[model samples]
Target: MKPFFVILLFSFLILIGCKGEEPLNDSIIIEVKTAGEKELSDLINNRNGKYLFLNIWATWCLPCVEEFPDIVKLSVNYKSDKIDFASLSIDYIEDKENKVIPFLTKMNTTFSHFINGFKKDEALINFINKEWSGAVPLTVIYDSSGKQVAMLEGAHTYDEFADKLNTLIK
Candidate 1:
């Protein structure tokens, strides 16, 4: 009886420990098209006269996650032919939909996904902004003429985001 009780106690302890040992969901993979030779041309030429809201973010950034809701709200509230919102995740190529896609799906984000395939962080930083300093949460708003009008780095509240959009819309 004593041996059985000891075994039961040990089993309970093991179960409790194992319960908290769930694996981290960060390694989930997403299917993303690496911007190849024609990718930039397609993105630019295809979006000739439309306003583009390009957000560069990653799943690990807290500020990026926090600001995502407002971006989603902005997309939902202002559905227009003149405006295009594209969210580009800097997550690893192998972990696109796995990590970032699930997060976006859970958040109900409607914007399209663009995943960066270049392993070199410097290339991405230089491509987005020469002075980007390799930040995770960077947003660039380009006007109809393909000129960047605003570039925001860091989390923004819904109202703050709305204000920015309002300026562009008007």
Candidate 2:
């Protein structure tokens, strides 16, 4: 009986030690497109008859990272066949392959992904949305007619994201 108790306690300790350790997926490969002012403009103008959900984020931003799993789930649930789902990372050009790709792989984001290609910060921010103050984890919703409907900034829970997406989806 004493040996059994010791074994159970040891297993419990192992489980506790493994908590919050996320494994990096080195096998999953993805190509993150580079989008500057031109590509962004093209996307906004070219998307037809599809509701677009665009999330602007970065690997370094904690709030952005925290909300990513929810975004990935939302993308899977509400795909482009019914609506458009995309993500844009504002990570520096050098970190595209080093940071963005690895993070996306770990998060399992298989949707439309992009990295900022332009050098100018303010220019890119203004181009995305003039009102945007270059904030990370910015989410923009556009209707089928290419009209901006909703814009959410900062970290959002899965329920919060779902609520916002539902409002725009309808």
TM-score of each candidate structure, all chains considered together = 0.74, 0.79
Query: Model 2, range 77-124, lDDT digits (tens) per residue?
Result: 877445778888989979997898888988877778889888888988
Q: In angstroms, what RMSD does candidate 1 have relative to the true structure?
A: 8.1
Worst 10 residues of 1 by lDDT: 23-32
Clashes of each: 7, 0
Candidate 2 residue spans exceeding 4 A from truth: 1-28
TM-score of 2: 0.79
Worst 10 residues of 2 by lDDT: 20-29
Tell me the lDDT of model 2 at 45: 62
The regions of model 1 sitting more than 4 angstroms off are 1-32, 36-38
lDDT of 1 by residue, 7-115 (tens): 9999999999988865344343334456632564466457667888888888988899988888888888877647788888888877775787778766665566778
Model 2 deviation from native, Cα RMSD in Å: 8.3
